[model samples]
Target: MRVMGIDPGTVVVGYGVIDSDAGRETMIAYGVLTASVKEKPAQRLSILYKSLEKIVLKFKPDAVAVETPFVSQNVSSALAIGRAQAVALLAATNRGIPTFEYSPAQVKQRVASYGASSKEQIQQMVKMQLGLSEIPKPSDAADALAVALCHLSEVHVSGLLGEQTPKRKRRSV
Candidate 1:
C-alpha cells in the first residue's frame, strides 16, 4: 500500500510518501511546501491546496494519514494549524482518497516506542526504519513519515485480526 502522510502548517507543510508491504516500508518521497510570509492567509491556503493536490496526483496514494493538532499555549498558532489541517483533509477528500487522523502522541509512540519521544529520537527512528542514510531535514518531514508509518502498522494489525476472525452474522441491537 502507498500512503501519504501530512504534517500541516500555514508557513510550511511537510509531506512524505511511503510504500509498505509484508511489514516492510520503503520511502518514496519526502519534502516540505513553504508559503511566503508576504502572501495573504487565503493565498497561502490556496498554495497549500494546490501543492497538496499535485502531490496526491503524483503519488496516487491509497490513503492519507495526517497528524492532528495538539493544544498549544498560543491559541492563534493552534488555530492556524487547524485551518491548515482542514485544507489538507479537503485536498485528499476532493481526490476521493481515504483520510485518517492520528494524534501526535500516537505518531510518537508508533515511530519511537514512546509517546514522549523527542524530535531527534523520532527523526532517528524514521531514518532507521526507512533505511535512509541520514535523518530527514526540517523535522516536519520526519513527522509526516512517522504518521505514514503509524498508518501502515495499523493496516498490518487490521489484516492480522481479519485473518484470525471468522465471519459472523450481525444481530440487531
Candidate 2:
C-alpha cells in the first residue's frame, strides 16, 4: 500500500510518501510545501492546495493520513492550521482516495512506542523504520512519515485481530 502522510501548516505543509508491503515500509519521497506569509491568505491557500494536489496525482497513494491540528490557546492560529489541514484532506478526497486523521500523540505513540516521545525520537524512529541512512530533512517531513506509518500500523494490527478500525468522519474543511 502507498500512503501519503501530511503535517499541515499555513506556511509550510510537510508531506511524505511511503510504500508499505507485508508490514515493511519504504520511503518514496518527502518534502515541504512552503507558502510565503506575505501572500494573501487566499493566495497562500491556493498554493498549498495546488502543490498538494500535484503530490496526490503523482504518487497516487492508496491512502492519505493527515495530522490533526492541535487545539491551541490561540484560536486564530489553530484555525489557520485547521484550514491547512483541510486543504491537504481536500486533495485526497477530490481524487476519491481514502483519508484518515491521527493526533500528534497517536502518531508519536505508534511510531516511537511512547506517546510522550520527543520530536527527535519520532524522527529517529521514522528513519529506522523506512531504512533511511539519515533522518529525513525538515522535521515536519519526518513527522508526516510518522503519521503515515502510524496509520499503516493501525491497519495491520486491526487486520491481524480480525477487526475493523474505526473510520474518521469527513468534513468540508
lDDT of each: 0.86, 0.90
Among these predicted structures, which one has the highest TM-score? 2
Error of 2 at 122 (Å): 0.4
lDDT of 2 by residue, 67-92 (tens): 99888588898899989998999999
lDDT of 2 at 65: 91
Please provide, for model 1 over 37-142, each residue's C-alpha lDDT reduced to its tens digit, 9 standing for 90 to 100.
8999989999999999999999999888888888869888888898998888888889888888888898898888899999888889999999999999878898
Model 1 C-alpha RMSD vs. true structure (Å) is 5.2
- The estimated TM-scores of all candidates read 0.91, 0.94
Worst 10 residues of 1 by lDDT: 164-173
User: Which sections of candidate 1 miss by over 4 Å?
Assistant: 163-173
57 Cα displacement, candidate 1 (Å):
0.3
